[model samples]
Target: MDNIDQIVDARGLACPMPIVKLSQAMTGMEVGQTVEVTATDHSFVPDIEAWCRKTGHQLIEVNEAEEEIKAYVKKTK
Candidate 1:
C-alpha cells in the first residue's frame, strides 16, 4: 500500500483479465516498482503467484477477502 507505484483495478473482470492488466502495467514499470491488483476472481491469488514465478517478478503479498483479492507484485527484471 505504501510503496505501490500502480494500482490495477480488475475487480469486475473475469479470468486472465486481471493478469493481463498486471502484465501490461509491468511493461513500463521500473525495476523494483510495485503494482497492486484487486480482483473478484478467487483464482487470482494462485494465478498471480504463478505469473510472478514465470516472469521473474517478485510476489510481495496477497490479501484475500470474501468479495475480492489483492495482489502486490514488484518488478525485479
Candidate 2:
C-alpha cells in the first residue's frame, strides 16, 4: 500500500454518501495520491467507476467480497 494516502470507510451509507465522503477525504490530497474506499454497497462497483470516470480519477483496482466492496482510486488530474 505504498503511496496510498488515505482510507475512507463508506459502509452503511448509500449512493452519494460514499462519493461525498470520498470527495471530502480527497479534498486535501495532492495530485497523484491514492484513496482506498471500502463500501458495503454492492452497487458501488459501477457507482465508483462512474464517479472516477466523470471526475478524471484513476481506478487502480476493485475487490469485492460477499459483504463489501473496495475500490482503490488515484487522483490523475
Candidate 3:
C-alpha cells in the first residue's frame, strides 16, 4: 500500500472499539504497514499500548490533543 496507511477514527468510541477497529484495519495490511487510530477515550491510552505490546505490533507515536489522543501503530502481521 506504500504510504497509504489505514486511518481509524475511534474518537468517541468506547474501550474496545478503538482496539477492535485497529485489529480490523490490520487484517489486510502487510507486515510493515501502519494504522493511525484517533480516540477521545483517555482511559484507552494505556490499554491500547498494552494490547499492542501483547500483539507484537509496534506503537510508532502517540500525540495527545486537547480532548483526544492519536496513536500510530505498525502492523507486524
Count of clashes, each model: 0, 0, 0
Whichever of 2 and 3 has more TM-score, that candidate is 2
lDDT of 2 by residue, 12-69 (tens): 8988798999999889888899999999988898999899989989999999999999
How does each model score on TM-score? 0.95, 0.92, 0.89
Quickly count the clashes in candidate 3. Answer: 0
lDDT of 3 by residue, 11-76 (tens): 899977888888888897889888888999997789778988999999888887889998888987
Which 10-residue window of candidate 2 scores lowest in summed lDDT? 1-10
- lDDT order, best first, reads 1, 2, 3
Task: In model 2, state the lDDT of residue 67.
Answer: 92
Off by over 4 Å in 1: none
Candidate 2 Cα lDDT to native: 0.90
Off by over 4 Å in 2: none
lDDT string for model 1 (15-76, tens) is 88999999999999999999999999998988998999999999989999999999899999
Clashing pairs in 1: none
- Looking at candidate 1, the ten consecutive residues that score lowest on lDDT are 41-50
Q: Arrange candidates by TM-score, highest first: which order?
A: 1, 2, 3
